[model samples]
Target: MGKADPKESYALGTAGRGLDPRAERSRAAALAAASDLLIENGWAGVTHASVAARSGVGRTTLYRHWPEAAMLIQQLLAELFQVEPVERTGELRADLIGELRSFLRVLHNPKSERALRVIIDQAPLDPRYAEVLSACSCKGTDGLREIVDEAKARGGLPKELDTDVAIDHLLGPLVFRRLISGQEFPDQYVPELVDSFLEPLTP
Candidate 1:
């Protein structure tokens, strides 16, 4: 990946004015185009021009909103995951399970899963994809850290482990099962995962 830093402020259109209805529609169309392009031609195809051509959004408008292919990639990810920053409830086990399910919903979606897979596989060659991947990963990591930190502040997670370690213990199996084992985790997966991680740390 060239590390093509769209270096995008990622705040092109809305420095001050939030997107109007018309602008929002145009951005949505472009994003839809990006999604289709990603699935059809992979990450390499989702340029501002390609999205404009597919979405019929003017280049000026596309540029005004998504200045680079990386922006399109980021937006496509936001669309696919719809994985909003799930509000924290301060309940460690429940919070962890909720976060996993938020991600699981995306994995269960065939198109979203395929798009994610494509981005990860192509990241080495497409710097744009890697940047988006790093950005998205950071967001998730932050959320997980928040959950663990809150639990620790409440005097939970008494064991000698940091938030990141706890997260690895909680998510490692899921990753291994999904990516390495080529398997779909069953209903028991999340609860069992939470229990295993929490049990060792609990007094």
Candidate 2:
């Protein structure tokens, strides 16, 4: 067989320019297809070929954009978890509660929970997945850090406590209970966790 033309391959799936309605539609279709595949099959089943087949987009189109399943899944998470930043209400207790509740909501979703478990389980096998998960954690941790900083600024945190460690102390129990024990995390537990951390912070 003769050599294939690289330019022809590239042009076959190229999205049109700005204000091009067809290009916009194609982009939306690709994203939606990828997201549905993730929700349905979790991380392991979301290959670029599968996504392209599901989306009706050529493999070249999918490769030209995402190049990998992890990248596509990460993009999906970023879009789905685009929560509004926690507003500083000047009340440390309220702020902490609000932030934690928001995080819980994200984790409690069955789809999200399954996706997270898959990613965590697969990370050991795939370095790229591990990197994707780490990046996602950093993004999430930044939000938690803001809440902790706000609490400190408002005098709700212990003077000598380390913020990172304090965050673990505050939130770690809930994660452990849910992820390890496979128990439901009730809203009532929020106040208890907050109180446990707050008592030490208060003089």
Candidate 3:
């Protein structure tokens, strides 16, 4: 499918200073372009020049914000999943379900899912991309760990629950189905999945 053109923005001159609204629009366009390239052509396609051409931002501006493609990829992944932590309601099951639903939504987004697949597929080829993937994975792990910690403190979860293993249990299957089988996790499955994971650990 043909992608839409990037929005028009005021070009920042060499002497431009202060909060240039155009700069924000340019950055947005660059990110959209980079993500599209990632999904369409994989990691090798997301260079500064390619992004600049697609985004209509100058090379100088793209380079000024993102020195490397890896950095740009990192930002792309980060922005796609900028979901806030689910509110803790002192109920472990409900809280976990809330977070799971949010995560599922992000993963199920077509662009985000495609971008993630590209990153994983290219990680073996480029050490820089491997690092970016690791960083993004760590962010997800940390968020899951926080939820586990909160649940434990609330006196419902098992103290022995290994947060790392628990996180893997929660996310691994969803990721497998999304990336490998290319099937969406039905919305009705959220509570079932959450219950299954919690049943083994919740006392």
Candidate 4:
């Protein structure tokens, strides 16, 4: 699969670009096909023409929206793993636990796990995919950073605390446990991770 062409830049939207339901469905179908192929056959299996065939969307429409297979894969990931807004419930501890739990839910899902593994394996070979993966990661990282910034602003955390490092500590263990160890990253693990990270920063 080739990288996204330098001449064409695709915006985040459906294939037809207008406010048409049919176009939206086609786009969703195409994305689902790409996601499935990536999960099942790895990055090499996903291509513009293959996705068009699998999705039953016309090649013209697929190419019109995503010319490159990498582009399709990137959009597929964006659709699958949406970066949600942080929920601040006026309680830092509760919010922290809630955020990590949401993360655990996604990481524990088999489909997402498969996609992540494919992305990780493909990153070294495909620079385009690496950029896409980094962008996706930034979405989650930025959301977590917002939570840390908000907590620090409210004096819940130490003023000098590094939000980036703080976020790494908060999410890193879950990633290790889920991806590295292949163990069940249970719900109960969320509280302990959140509390331990907060304890030192809190007081």
Candidate 5:
């Protein structure tokens, strides 16, 4: 048999300029356009047609990939929230502190914060958006679960503490403080939060 061209091997999917550059560029453009629209008009202003126009991709292509703006925005947030793997660091306090700091940074962004609020506010009226927002939140909670589990393993927390409740205890106050106070949380509060939560759990 004749040796098949190497290009032929990759041609089945994205090979031959069909798969790599064009697809990636289109996806990036869509995300960029969606982000701009989100920041400018909030979630209400993003539509599949608008995104396609702004992204310079065909409306058909956009529809083929993401049928709705909510899905597209969900995808955009998923990309934005991507972070390095959580570090165990062999010290529960350090690990919790690091994760919380990162979380606060993400939640504190004005545009991102506003975007999330819009999704949440619209949830009751739009069930589809609720589902999307719920999925995004669950992804974030999974990250929190990792930190809590690590703390349990390192003997920094009580053996019997329920992880879900423990996570609530740790994070609930910080979120409430942010939303209610409408002020930036001081860096000193992070250690205080860690110390307060850890103190009650330690043997």
Candidate 6:
């Protein structure tokens, strides 16, 4: 039920250091157990007691580290959503296609997909989750921004175009296709969609 090789950086960062290896294992086990709990039971199912029972890491330890569901969720997200920055190939169409392909790969993983669903489900009702979600989002935003900036500098896109709107135009469809449609076409759909966007833009 847990992700294989749970990331210790997120745990170490959130809880602070100075723990023995055994203590680190206990913390990582708790986080992994909580992640499994989130996937299996969603937000409502995860509690300090539940995580303690699942991980056998003790309720007091869960309370000491996570303190609340939001904090625990924050730690989980920090580990799960490791969005990498996009590398530009100097071609707008190619860069965009690469971006979508990369994003789709992340979404293709069932564990990551479930984590996103949980965050999206909670962000509306909880400000803490919203904050964490925003942090994750900014990483994506930066990548798109870079692609757009590079495209504009190369005269691939109009100089006067609103970058924010452009980012939406570029990323919105792939996101919509995956999250809203609940459909995935990571291989065949990427290029067709990229071409569809660029056809109107090209002079």
TM-score of each: 0.71, 0.76, 0.74, 0.80, 0.75, 0.84
Q: Higher lDDT: candidate 1 or 4? A: 4
State the displacement of the C-alpha of residue 46, model 1, in Å, after optimal TM-score superposition: 3.0
Instruction: Name the runs in model 3 displaced over 4 angstroms.
Output: 1-25, 60-68
Clashing pairs in 5: 14-19
Candidate with maximal TM-score: 6
Question: Where does candidate 6 have its weakest 10-residue lDDT segment?
Answer: 1-10
**Candidate 3 per-residue lDDT over residues 98-184, each given as its tens digit:** 877767776877666665676687679877557657766765566667888877776778777778888888888888887788776
Query: What is candidate 2's lDDT per residue for 111-160, written digit by digit as tens?
Result: 55655666678669876557656665665567778778766776667556
Model 1: per-residue Cα lDDT over 37-131, one tens digit each: 88788777888778889989999988876666676676576456434578767677888898887666656666566656766786798776676
As for candidate 3, its clashing pairs are none
Put down candidate 5 lDDT per residue, 67-156, tens digits, no spaces.
666667666654444334566676778878877776676577765565566667777887655765676566556767877876677666
Q: What is the C-alpha lDDT of each candidate?
A: 0.70, 0.66, 0.71, 0.74, 0.68, 0.75
Model 3 scores what on Cα lDDT? 0.71
Q: What TM-score does prediction 4 earn? A: 0.80
- What's the true lDDT of residue 13 in model 6? 36
How far out, in Å, is residue 61 in model 6? 0.9
Weakest lDDT window of 10 consecutive positions for candidate 3: 7-16
lDDT, candidate 1, at 112: 65
Query: Tens digit of lDDT per residue, candidate 4, span 1-203?
Result: 12344333343323234425776688778888888887788778889878888989999988877777777776666556654565678788888887877777778665666667766777788876576568667766775777789888989888789888898899999889888987875557888888788777765
Q: Which one is best on lDDT?
A: 6
- Candidate 5's C-alpha runs over 4 A off are 1-20, 110-115, 123-128
Which pairs of residues clash in candidate 4, taking residues 3 or more apart in a chain or in different chains? none
Model 1 is weakest, by summed lDDT over 10 consecutive residues, at 8-17
